[model samples]
Target: MKILIVEDEQEMLNNMRQSLEQELYIVEAASNFKSATEKIGVYDYDCILLDIGLPDGDGLELLKYLKKQGKDDGVIIVSAKDSLDDRLKGLDLGADDYLPKPFHMAELNARIKAVLRRRNFDGNTLVEIGNVLIDTESRIIKIADEKIILNRKEYSILMYLIANKTRLVTKTALAEHVWGDHIDQTDSFDFIYSQIKNLRKKMDKATITVEAVYGVGYKLEVE
Candidate 1:
């Protein structure tokens, strides 16, 4: 999953970023409101860890920006202020959850998972398409009730494609979600093609196909 950490506390930001990255999430950060706004304007994230306090602007305004853009990216307000009013306001402003300061990283991870499940999978950990089944929490994939092992990038690509099964997913979107900031350094989509090729071979026995749209992108076609 891709996440944005909007925090001003350098230490806290580093800690959260490191922890989330260790959990195999693509993480990006902005120490101030301006940078955060720039990122929010450009890309979509699976979840955003937003701090209500910023050096220059209120993080609540960022929530407003997201709503105005009609973006439904899941948000969790991570703030030092723990008042009931603040929590209610954040939720009212479209935040999926709230985490107070000085909380455990494990708890934060759990909250993120919960929000993702609620938002994307209708509160279910399993994602099923045709005969293929994915257990998001356990990171397992089963076809016809038989387990299949996939490399990390391959798994990420499959999950992303399944999430947008009804639409054409561009190479840029896939790279951004799977490789994160590292996509910027890539010179071509060759790496994406390689991963997709491997994933298609692994899923050959399944009732789904990843169809390439010539020079454009790919779409998941289910039988």
Candidate 2:
């Protein structure tokens, strides 16, 4: 999973990064509202840990902006404010959860997992499609009770497809989701074709079927 940590305190930011990195999440950091807004505009994150007391602006404004832009990214407020009003305001602004300062790292991890589950997996810990099973917590994919080895990008692609199962995902969408906004610099989508080919081969070996949509895109047609 990819996450953005927006906090001004250097010590707290480093602590959050270390804890989340140990859990195998790709993490990026922003110290202020401008940097956070820039990152949000360009990169797609599975979850964002936002600090309300930003240097330039209130994090609530950012949340509202994201909502206005129709971004469904999961957000959690990690701030020094622990009052009822603050919590209520953040929740009302579409924050999945609110965590005050001096929180346990384990608790933050749990909140992130829960938020992701609610956002992507229909509140389920495991996602099953035919013979393939995805354990979101472990970030592992299994077929017929045997684990399948997948590279980082491949796993991300498969997870995205599974999340939007039965829907045609265009090459442009896939590239943006997997490679973020940086894909605009690429001249061709040949790498995407290669990734899809390898994913299909792996799925075929495991008796899982993922369908191609010819010139349009791909779909997960399990069973």
Q: In terms of lDDT, which candidate is strongest?
A: 1
How do all models score by TM-score?
Answer: 0.57, 0.56
Clashing pairs in 1: none
lDDT of each: 0.86, 0.82
Q: Which residue ranges in model 1 land beyond 4 Å of their true spot?
A: 123-223
Winning candidate number (TM-score): 1
* Each prediction's RMSD to truth: 13.0, 14.8
lDDT of 2 at 181: 62
Candidate 2 least-lDDT 10 residues? 102-111
lDDT digits (tens) for residues 1-223 of candidate 2: 9999999999999998997887688999999999999999888889999999998999999899888878988999988878889899989989889888766554576578677778877746787778888887788888888888889999988877765556566777677768876886899877898998888888775545667788767767756
